[model samples]
Target: MEFHLEHPLSHSSLHNDDADDNTLPLPLFLVEFQHMPSSHYFLTLKSSASLLSNRNFAISSITQYSRKFDDPSLTYLAVNYLDRFLSSEDMPQQQSKHWVLKLISLSCVSLSAKMRKPETSVCDLQVEGEMFDAQTIERMENVVLGALKWRMRSVTPFSFFSFFISLFDLKEEDPSLLKHSLRSQATDLTFNLQHDIKFLEYKPSVIAGAALLFNSSELCPLQFQCFSNRICQCTYVNKEELMECYKAIQERDAIGVEENEGSSETAVNVLDHQFSSCGESEKSITITAASSPKRRKTSTRRC
Candidate 1:
């Protein structure tokens, strides 16, 4: 993870003196990372076929359905709901049921749409045309609400974009333009990479770092070393983990190959064995959205 910096940053460069209102301050950003799924959750996603299939279905459904709307945040936020719901100790029984999975996916998009546009109702966001009534969708929404413990606001990688961009020492005259370009490129990667299950192993912060580092190599090859060194020096970053995620993204980008899970055994005892609680309380964080090629347009809303 180490990089040779021809011109090393001074101690002051590592500290954020001015805070951007759109981005979380450093202290709050660190607190938000605590709410991400625990490492055990990733293990369960690997071990259980039912869980993996449900996740795949939910993500795919959300991706397909979310295309009609022009909001990028909806897909990511809906997937976030799906992940948190699946990660909870009390998931709905019959994980293999198609109707139940559709209900879950529908309810998630409905909820995200409501958060972004209060005028939009559950009935309006129904996917694949009226699969379930509004009342049934609302009930499932309640189930999702309970599973997430009423924590609708999510802390995603977007929350860290501005904060991380600030860490770089941009010598360009229009630093804001460079920052916007970097953020846009990184945003594209974060949205597209969500389909890959392996990324679940990394935290949003680590994912953001990897995406930024990956893009920096192309956008500013000359300053890549300096940017990497500054990011490594950040107190909140785990250098090893960042490098691991970075390499994984690089490999995926190089091959342009998307990984798909193979057929597996039944879903027996998966909920009882894998979806149990972590036996500890979790915290919370806020989120926002962005526009990109693979993403829909979105208004500001907590993910």
Candidate 2:
């Protein structure tokens, strides 16, 4: 496997026209993301406390259920579809049932896999425990696709890795190994932290860069500062916001450190679930919700 790590001029300009190819420019979709952010997640849930509390809990279950599937990308895409759909669509006033939400999850994951890994079979993705039939999955996917405007290629933090890595300009022997390693670490961190509502405020590119910064300190201790300095010099990135994001990642990392030092594993999960509720002024995530055709109302909380 070959990976394209070219330095793209702007994330707003790259596109992969060939269907057989899976290449995506980090910028083009990002341009759309400016107007399409997920910050409304918790606030929208606040609007209907009863609906949000119940559905958010179910959403958490769906997130866990998504683990039964093979790829993390599928979960990411499904969540993207879910968020975009809920944020924009007013739920049928009749209220939702658990099965209906499950179908939505199945459809979101199904659609996610198809978009990212086209070769993946829908039947295989259904796996054990998924109750939705092919037609049902297809129907739900249609609703989600329409809500998300068929923009299946979401602008996630992963999208910005190539461009950010290219900025470091590593000159080591087999530099590719170093770059690939850092990207892997950052990608893992991104997935782990994706459930946090706080990350919603930062642009995907900013989050991608911050993840790289966090990993570089661990993956390339000596050269990490240089990478950090280079990113800070980036005109497009906001230094203050990047540091805020970096701090949040660090706070998350601290939970691991605490566990390694003898804290209970159960305690860590509890701490993370209440992470946003911590109410630390600096760690706060605030996004005002408004009417939008494509924004999601949010259906699940990252448990």
Q: Model 1 over residues 1-303: C-alpha lDDT tens digits?
A: 111110011123333344343343565445554446555666676677677788888777787767777777778878877887777766742356777778888888887776655676665566555568778988989998888777666667776777678888899999888788898999888887776766776777788888998899899887877888877787777776676577667657765554432223212121122222323534111111223342222111111
**Which candidate leads in lDDT?**
1
Clashes of 1: 4
Alpha carbon lDDT of residue 194, candidate 2? 58
RMSD of each: 14.6, 9.7
> Across residues 81-176, which tens digit of lDDT does each residue of candidate 2 receive?
666666665345235777777777667776766665566676765547656677877888788777777766666777677667877867789898
| Candidate 1 accuracy as TM-score | 0.74
Top candidate (TM-score): 1
TM-score, model 2 to reference: 0.67
Model 2 segments more than 4 A misplaced: 1-26, 29-37, 45-69, 91-96, 119-130, 171-174, 257-303
The residue pairs found clashing in candidate 1 are 70-297, 71-297, 72-296, 154-303
The alpha-carbon deviation from the true structure for residue 16 of candidate 1, after best TM-score superposition, in angstroms, is: 16
